[model samples]
Target chain A: MVLYCEICSLPVEFCEFGKSFKKCKLWLQSNNNEIYNKLYNSDIKSSLSKEEEEKISNSLAKMQLKEERKLERDLINLQNSKILIKRIPRTKHKYIVAIANLDLLDPNLFDMKKTCKKFASKFATGCSISKNSEKKDEIVIQGDVADEVESYLREFIDSNGINIKIEHVTERFTNKKK
Target chain B: MFKKFSKDDVHTRTNVKSSVAKTLKSKLVSQYPKLEDVIDEIIPKKVPISLYKCEDKIQLYVVNNEILFYQQFDDLIPELRLVHKYPDAFPSVQVDRGAIKFVLSGANIMCPGLTSPGAKLPEEDWPVNKIVVVYAEGKENAMAVGKLAMSINDIKTINKDTGIELYEYLNDGMWNFRD
Candidate 1:
């Protein structure tokens, strides 16, 4: 069985070649100590000479630094981004919840369709992913479950180690005579 | 070739018919006779296969959300994950330890890298345009897959210039892509 690094998602042996080698090593050491010892403790010297080894390590360090910077930037962007859950009044009392910017949390962890399905089942309402007026994909629920959705999203974000704010907005449509 | 691939590039995705899946399995077996022994294990008969038509006329065969292989034109090139499962099923060459960094970064394999002391090329000459799995000098697993730009014999003799056109490599867009 190929052991993949939980941190980098690369095979354990290839973790050195991945971007998050430091994190991968820590993760492997904690999760699979046997394989970690086999990979890192084995004092098998590389075939490359001193100069080539230094050059490769230097380049790898530089690349890792760049990757770290990029990740920091992404986190900063995430910190600024907010998930908006709008409760729009459709009829006299009926309301629908439209969730926007949920993708900002994390594209990899959050699948819109799956999230919609979860909401549909949990709230016992019809949920779908639809384009908003701004052409951004948003999860539209057919019932007024804004508070429940907000709490669920907050828990989801907190569990994922992300700190993002979820804002609520209520939209009221009034009839007017011209 | 798959450096910039993403989910947005996918145009259409449809379930491959059982008949076509059988033909595909046969085609795969014919291309690499070694796969005959474990083709059933790789792609189970009961599982439904999805064919994703992507940008640049590329087609990807996905089984159970894992991309098994992709087709550019006529050839069905197995992904690195599939190659890792059955390393010996494909024709492969090794590059020197020095070339591993470059290969992982999506650089084409140079003749010198293959002909170097630590590297190993097959004694039997494979013709140009043949797909070959690329392994690092000391690594236990493959790092990339590519097509031969020059025949193996020519690469041995010339020992200069690009020898293989890299298709998919470790950490590239395709390797990191998740459906």
Candidate 2:
């Protein structure tokens, strides 16, 4: 069973990155004060004196310069990382669709939920965007339209001017009859 | 090497027996005798150790709710800034301004990077085989944590021109690890 926050219903792991974390923090304050204290004072101390700030900034500047030199040293090792779209047969006529490498797309222009909703509307009625507990986003459509969806995404991304190469990966589900 | 870690994988990989946790903790204490005083504080009382693989040759340990330490070459090295935020939790060495980029990019640190006016020498006994946190000349938080290649005396007397080994650093698979 997927664990979700009782207050906001977001996945427990992602609660900290979502709005539900604020509610969780409020609950922690009243019910688990010890935990609240631990989380509150967990990170590095934020307060720094002027001299410390100056020293850190100077180090940062020097570090940046050194980083440039390192980058120049390794130009041949660069390799292309591709975005993968996978289709797997879930049932007789249904499919589970997953799109990996969403980081290649600009977040401002690419909305996973909206794009999935639009794509599913063309072929099936129960198309929706679902997120795993780990927060990996996937678009699920009820009916099997894997071929159509793959072509549609290609045209859609091409028209949008994104420079990412997409790889189509297919995994067929095998049923074991006992 | 960086990838998302599912909660299911976490449970599978790290669901260690209590006996295993006890043994691991004992091995850790044996490795770093200085941790005897804070052994209880570092190891969780009842919880099983959660392990996350941070690339090849590196692994992270999560006890209770915090990522307390990482392991390399059979040595358990505690998380520098993330763990033991107390002033004297771990020994530290400061690197020059130019070394920040290389450290973040997962490169082994060189002696030239530490030969700066702002560099803080590691204590005489603190350098050899010890897990020391690395900080930039100006930064308060440690940018990386790594095992030292040379003792303070070796560094003082035999100035090596090349190949100073460091265990781990910022932006390495360990730092970017998520579960």
Candidate 3:
């Protein structure tokens, strides 16, 4: 049986409940306990429409293919690609800045009009957006100064008492597909 | 876990209150000086906004919606018109966790946080005030009254704590359409 990745919406297979041809490591579980527990104890299992189930299964197949490709690419890159980690030329940040989270911390709702006002008012370098999986989830801010953004984010989250987990990624990010 | 909030010296970005209420969508429309008059060098004629909504949340469009960019705000309708959809807009509804408040009050508000189509068609860069928790009946299960910090697709891509919070006690409350 195929399950869905809650974050990426790609299909996933639990070693326990899914096809045992491959191992599932991205899951935050040792076994398919979360799925089993929910299935056995929840009200949602009975409501699975055939299409919904198939969608999830299709997602799983896609994910499995993606996993294989990613693994192969990683191996190939390890052998040929230079490991020189790229960094922003930290001379001075530009006046306007954009930041992103690897996990699509937010959807880009920046009021295009206000950019001028805000930029004119503040010393931002460039704008970074939250990164999103290809059409899979919300996009996060984008920025090389992710650390500074995190400090600001922590302040916002802390002051507001928000309980959310935010993460950052290294290496340059690709643009989001519309 | 929540940390202590230092309201006394909350070091915030200068224009960092609710941008919608304080700066962009302020109440006293005439009070503030017209920005165009204030700064002739910058400021565009019209800006775009990304809109978000909460439903079965499919197609996490994280990228591609933000043709316009600016500070985040709290309303989604004004931005809705930018997208070519039904010109008719959905009223912005505020609801407690389960949209418990609206479902009780009875405004075509559906979803745990679902309100309706905002003034804009759905876009990733849309601004928002709250997200609705919706049900299969095409009505709201609850109205999660929180600012849309991210776009509709942005929220869909991640595991939202508010969503987790909404689901925690969603079914426990009884519907009271009194409001």
Q: For each predicted model, how many residue pairs clash, with residues at least 3 apart or on different chains?
A: 0, 2, 67
lDDT of 3 by residue, A22-92 (tens): 44443434456775465334543323356855665565576667766887896675445321112332324
How does residue A176 of candidate 2 score in lDDT? 52
Q: After superposition, how far is residue A117 of candidate 3 from its true place, in Å?
A: 31
What docking class should model 3 receive? Answer: incorrect
Candidate 1 scores a C-alpha RMSD against the true structure in Å of 4.1
Interface RMSD, one decimal, each candidate: 1.6, 12.0, 16.8
| Candidate 3 lDDT over residue span B41-66, tens digit each | 22132332222321222111111333
DockQ of 2: 0.06
DockQ of each: 0.43, 0.06, 0.01
Candidate number that wins on DockQ, 1 or 2: 1
Q: Model 1: per-residue lDDT, tens digit, B1-179?
A: 98888899999999999999999999999999999999999899999999999999999999999999999998999999999899899999999889988988889999999998889999998999999999887678888999999999999999899999999998889988977
Docking class of 2: incorrect
lDDT of 2 at B125: 50
Better of 2 and 3 by TM-score: 2
Pairs of colliding residues, candidate 1: none
Model 1 TM-score on a 0 to 1 scale? 0.81
Chain B TM-score for each model? 0.98, 0.74, 0.23
